[model samples]
Target: MVNKSKVTINDIAKAVNVTAATVSRALNNNPRISEATRKAVQKAAKELNYQPNNIAAALRHGKSHLIGVIVPRADRAFFSSVIRGIEEIANEINYKVIICQTYEDLEKEAQTIETLVNARVDGIIASISKNTIDFSHYQSAIDKGFPVVLFDRTSDQVTVNQVVIDDYYGAYEITKHLIDQGSKSIAYLTSPIKINIYKDRLRGYMDCLADHNIDYDERLVVESNLQLQDGRQSMEKLLSGQRTPDAVFSASDYGIMGALQVLKERGIRIPEDIALAGFGNEPFTSFTDPTLTTVDQLSITMGRVTAELFFDQLKGSKKKHHEPHKTMLKPGIIVRQSSLKKGLNQENSPISEEYKELP
Candidate 1:
């Protein structure tokens, strides 16, 4: 009968006719081990079905070679793209990635962070959840001296490495675009402004209106969770209100999609009867009827830079105390059929001066 026991380094070393220590060095790609010997040890390990003990290795090196990533929702294309970028970099550096989805729930996010901490992951990257008003869980991680990096939905309360897009600028440009297209009484659609990103976007929207000498009407602003159904209901409520907006600027593509559906059902021509714009530049935005004009947040690049920041923290920790690093990338506005009411004369438009420095 064949032995069913698990194969170890000793088995590979015996098969390769080398010492157990030599096998270990070869498996770890230690510079002292010759390339030929490394190949021989690897082949023997493959033949013997030897599995290296990660726990033992981690104990010796004081690092698990595992990274934890937490996001609001992994199913979203934006978050998924960020995870892909993080995974790509982690793989190249011989690190393993463990992902956790918060589903926009604060309790779930806290539990996931605690679980990762208990697992002894080398580092963590996270985007704060929408319901994360209290940051005690994140504070616990920081207090424990664990490397934590924040991206996208971040907070000023936590001082750590962060990677984000310029939300304020992106929102300003989009709102200005709507105004330049002859949209008077523009409506703003958004969620809770407690989160820094949402707050910045809301500020940008208001600032743009003030800059253009447009009155900031509180009645025209609609605040909800920014869900699809919420967006539909919000639109319905907006139309039923005393003041009707000629244009709508949504903070999320999904919400805008719902608004678009309502407008289409009501036989309102886009950019004619009521112009529209959205954020996040999701894939479906380009495929929507009349193609939605939205802002591209550079999701993948944001992820890559975020991972790079973690690596920087790791490397810098050897010298002195690592200072917090903050990186903000400029977001691009995708001009499409939905918000281009003034024809294709964007270069010579009235708002050209405001957008001259923008890409």
Candidate 2:
């Protein structure tokens, strides 16, 4: 009688009459392992009740085969989709993921990175919190050649590899769509410039207005946390102001939801009375009283690319991206009823309704 909990991979190897090395590769799902032999080894392990020890394996290889994923919050559709994308690619390579949420707190963000490092994770993929202006935590890890890949929300202060969308382009196109719909007084809801995404989006909106010969109004630009409450406050400020905006464009979908609430409570008709647009094509955007016109960040694709960049930084990886810093994928602008003053069919964009791949 053998103890099921005490059965190890070596024990399973003996039962299958295969070398321990073969068992290890088979268990790890190495591509080189034949399917028949892999199945036989797995069967032997199951029958023997072999219990694999992750800690022991990590000690032997100096790698835990685990990576940390840090996001602002997983409750949102965008972050959750990005996580799914990351996990899919990571699992394919036999690496597991440990997800952490910062809840937009800078302290928690730094602590999460340290904890993952202490656990000896092979790498980390993170999107910084809104309040994370200081890049010291990420920079410290990068200085030591630690694998750190940032996505979506990132800081220019860090020199690490990053996967991000063309924020400027997304903003420009969305704002242009509004302008073409006769939105001359378009109010902008934005955030602090510390994070490059907001800054780029703001730049895009302003540049688009200028290109269309529209005067840039400082009173129409409201900067806040880009949350739902912040959105509401910003929208109120725009409405109560001496000059009323015909349209409102928020840097985030969360913020736009708040603005939408304010608009609805005030009995303002969407698109007709006040056109609205938002970044992050969050699912709730479509379910609103009037669907929202927003930018799709390609959350899942961003995750896969982030994972790939992390692997490129790994020591034994075959493919090395010489200059990964230039990796910037295109963004998709989704048009809907919320901002389509001229109706949905009139949207002069290749990116319409659904997210399309970049050519």
Candidate 3:
């Protein structure tokens, strides 16, 4: 039996009775090679179990046709949906994706970028980790003229192709909804403001409160990691404070869900006692006891658009593309039982209401 790894172009050429050069051209589908020769060479290659060295081919072509995708975590529904969206566009263009997770660690994120760069991937698609504050790592890749498109968790500090949800709009709409439902002391559970998403969201919430003539209480705004455990701890702390919040607007679905569990355990009635809302319209948000009201970031659409943007920046021709651009997908409020204390009230903010009323 022929050693699978040992099979080479010479071996295939011998079987097909052609020179190695002819075999190479045929394998590469060069127009000079006849279709019959191409077929014969390909047939022999399959039968001989000749696995082509993609890395070697990429080195010769100067294009790996491989894209590296970086996300905080693959387990989350929002990130997964974004991946799915990217794949949909990538598959059409015959590109392969290599996904890397940083688990929200800045060090790991930097390392992953370096690793992908050294691997010589044609391009990269990334969502900045929550812990990331420095733009040097991302700037380095851009300085080298590497194609990168960032989605979801992106920052204003870096100049790169960014596709993200309208975070401020999302936050404002949700906050206004809670206010419309008669919530006065609204608690905002958010992440560290180092990241743009959280910062813009916080601004939106505060601005909405101010616009509605409601007092902006610094005591009501809690900052943390915005994870499930962090949510629980933040909620517990808020409840223990001297001022009990009439509503809660968390920056993340995971954080709010954690708060939900704590609230349920403490026998607190949702919406009735404290209206609750979160960002990221995660799948489980639909099935919770009183379904969750959250912001839909158009995750899949973000992914697909980001991939398209990457291709645009990629060197399709000699034409020079200018500086990076931004695409903001309009986010909508998914009003569920959780935040519908006063159903379908007029939007207080000048921004028109875009609602997804789910059962």
Q: How many clashes does each candidate structure show, in the order listed?
A: 0, 0, 0
Sort all candidates by lDDT, best to worst. Answer: 3, 1, 2
lDDT, candidate 1, 267-348, per-residue tens: 9899887888999978898899988888888888888889889977876656546678679999888778888787767557
| Model number with the top TM-score | 3
lDDT of 3 at 78: 93
Candidate 2: worst-modelled 10 consecutive residues by lDDT:
315-324
Q: Per-residue error at 146 for model 2, in Å?
A: 2.5
Question: TM-scores of all models?
Answer: 0.90, 0.84, 0.91
User: Which lDDT values do the candidates have, in the order given?
Assistant: 0.86, 0.86, 0.87
lDDT of 3 by residue, 1-359 (tens): 66777899999999999999999999888999999999999999999999878778878988888999999999999999999999999999889999999998999999999988888888789998877888788888876767878998888788887998889988988898898889999999988657788879999999999999999998898998888999999999999998999899999998999999999999999989989999998899989988898999888888899999988888652456577788988887888888877664455433223455222
Flag the better candidate by TM-score, 1 or 3.
3
**Residue 209 Cα positional deviation in candidate 3, in Å, after optimal superposition:** 0.9
Query: What global local distance difference test value does model 1 have?
Result: 0.86
Residue-by-residue lDDT tens digits, candidate 2, 1-359: 66787987778788888999999999989999999999999998889878788667767887888999999999989899999999988999888999999999999998988888777788789999988878888877665556888899887787777888999989998899899888999999988656888889999999999999999999999989888899989988888999999999999998899999999999999999899999998989989988898999898898888888788787543344434484687988888889877775535555566655434
